[model samples]
Target: MADHRAQDKLAFLLSLVPYLVDHDRVSVAEVAAHFGVPQSQIRDAVRLIGVSGIPGETAQYQHGDLFDINWDDFELNDQIVLTNRVAIDDSPRFSAREAAALIAGLQYLSALPEHADRAAVASLMAKLSRGASAVPSSLTVEATATDGTLALIRESVSTGVQIEFCYRSAQGEAQSRRVDPLRIESFDADWYLRGWDHLRQGVRTFRLDRISEPVITTEPITFRAQDVTLPETLFEGSPEDLLVTIDVVPSAAPLLADYIPAGAVTTEIGGLFRTTIRVSHYHGLKRLLASMSGMATVVEPAEARTAVAEWAAAGAARYR
Candidate 1:
């Protein structure tokens, strides 16, 4: 979902660059009103044009000032004229490995239970990988059932059957609990069982991966039609609650943008773009942070500072 939204925003922004270059000194208010975006957002979009360029700026397209945008008199004089003819064209580039990975990832996302619309997913995946002609010949993902735990959980939730299971917490601590199954969910590449715990007397999310023993229940449970607990609060203590910010390149922004809330991301006056995201856990954040190595930079939560330092130290040690 995040990936889809980010790509949409990138397409929107990239689409605007051509328009801006074509009609220089465009009316800020007019552009915003036309696009249904805030005036500030349009200004940011103009700033983005200043830094983005096709390659070496030559006679065809000037390097830096290809789109000579002047927002100084932007408010009163809402007209922006293109001093240089900036040729904005989409040159799609992808490595064989990257192309293959994208195909594999799309397949995994499409195969999830929540994303049962395989046809729609396939269409979208094809659209995303249009530039990459090389298609993966065969892709298959597998998940071994935990002694009918998943089947039992689904039936138990529908049938209002109480269940007991031994599970491991995120911290790898062992726990045994009885819960009245409510709803099952898949998030961030894992399935979760959201239910009302008998002992804790509160809502809990049990990770399907951490279920050590088989789920079994002798007693019948009553499933309430009304929600007993807030869905937002259920993930409060999880890593998804951790807020993170990073400055990313435009190319990478399409991947990270949707993870952040709309209107939360903004470009600096100088044209550097940044995104803020609320991650669910430390491990997930670590993985995400590691993947975007050079393009991503951590910007908030001083606590993450320690983790960054530790990671850097580890890398340094490896090199040494």
Candidate 2:
């Protein structure tokens, strides 16, 4: 605790000199009040500054080597004034690593839906590149899927082509499907591919991470991006969206965004995130809970938990 206090005192003193230099001429009382310290502490800082400066080439402190202050004004009126000021650094630059980090962040911002100025972000990145003292290592922000899956989806969307991929369904079944690439959207850290499915014969949403063996076919898209009307939310709703409230782990909450209505409020209870989400029926909810395992538990509408229990018993009976 004492060492921490000493460190804090050193930081305060280091900052005090810069503030005093910026003000040029300030009262001891004013400095103390500004720093939220007592008047004595301010006077002590002034005395400390009086003796602090860079050493000359000679191993001894020369006349100008030490900071000088007006003693009369300090003694009589408690006014603080620096007669000798050391050189201050004004042109500070970010390190190569720091510049690279910032440039990477700017690149990500440019890709966001709300960020409109790509040129501006590019200009800033160029400035950072030049201002860096050393060449930064080539670093970039990659999409949520890094195995060339997102790139293929992007190619399909841009070229107006249908993409074929083996999509892993909610029931852990993989089926070969072709989708007319409509739009690629991101929710939080996860990315979703919304397109017209040839097999389902309707618009379907697929999680990019679950899509595998993606290939862009030579066939052109039946429906273009501008022609289709996408829902404000990624998933289209029907009269069958059964609202089943559940207590899910906080980390898994974003995965349920498709089921969570836009206006529904989620609350935290008993160290779990409590939110209501829509499912087609109780059987589907039971399956979802089974997949999640212990990551989530049903919290309300008692039938939801009962549905899960019944499904488990029925599965066990088959084995028996």
- Which candidate gets the maximum lDDT versus the true structure? 2
Consecutive 10-residue window with the lowest summed lDDT within model 1: 81-90
Candidate 2: tens digits of C-alpha lDDT, residues 1-320: 99998898889988998887655568988998898999999898788888877777895788778888998999999999877665453267688999989999998766542243467778788767755667776888875553377667667766667889998866578999999877668765567778888898888888887899999999888876667787778767678677888999999887787788769989999899999888867866886777777788887788887888888889989997
lDDT, candidate 1, at 18: 65
Q: What tens digits encode model 1's per-residue C-alpha lDDT throughout 1-320?
A: 99998897788777786666444246878788878889888877667666655545353444553555554565457665544333443355565567667777877665443344567777665544533434444555565664257666655655566878897866577888888776666665567777788878878778787886656587787544265744653354444377777777777776664367646846752455776876765556776777777877777777775777687779879987
TM-score of each: 0.43, 0.46
Return the top candidate by TM-score: 2
lDDT of each: 0.65, 0.79
The alpha-carbon lDDT assigned to residue 89 of candidate 1 equals: 30
lDDT of 2 at 115: 43
Q: After superposing candidate 2, which stretches have Cα over 4 Å from the reference? A: 1-98, 105-127, 131-137, 140-146, 198-202, 247-275, 280-297, 301-303, 306-320
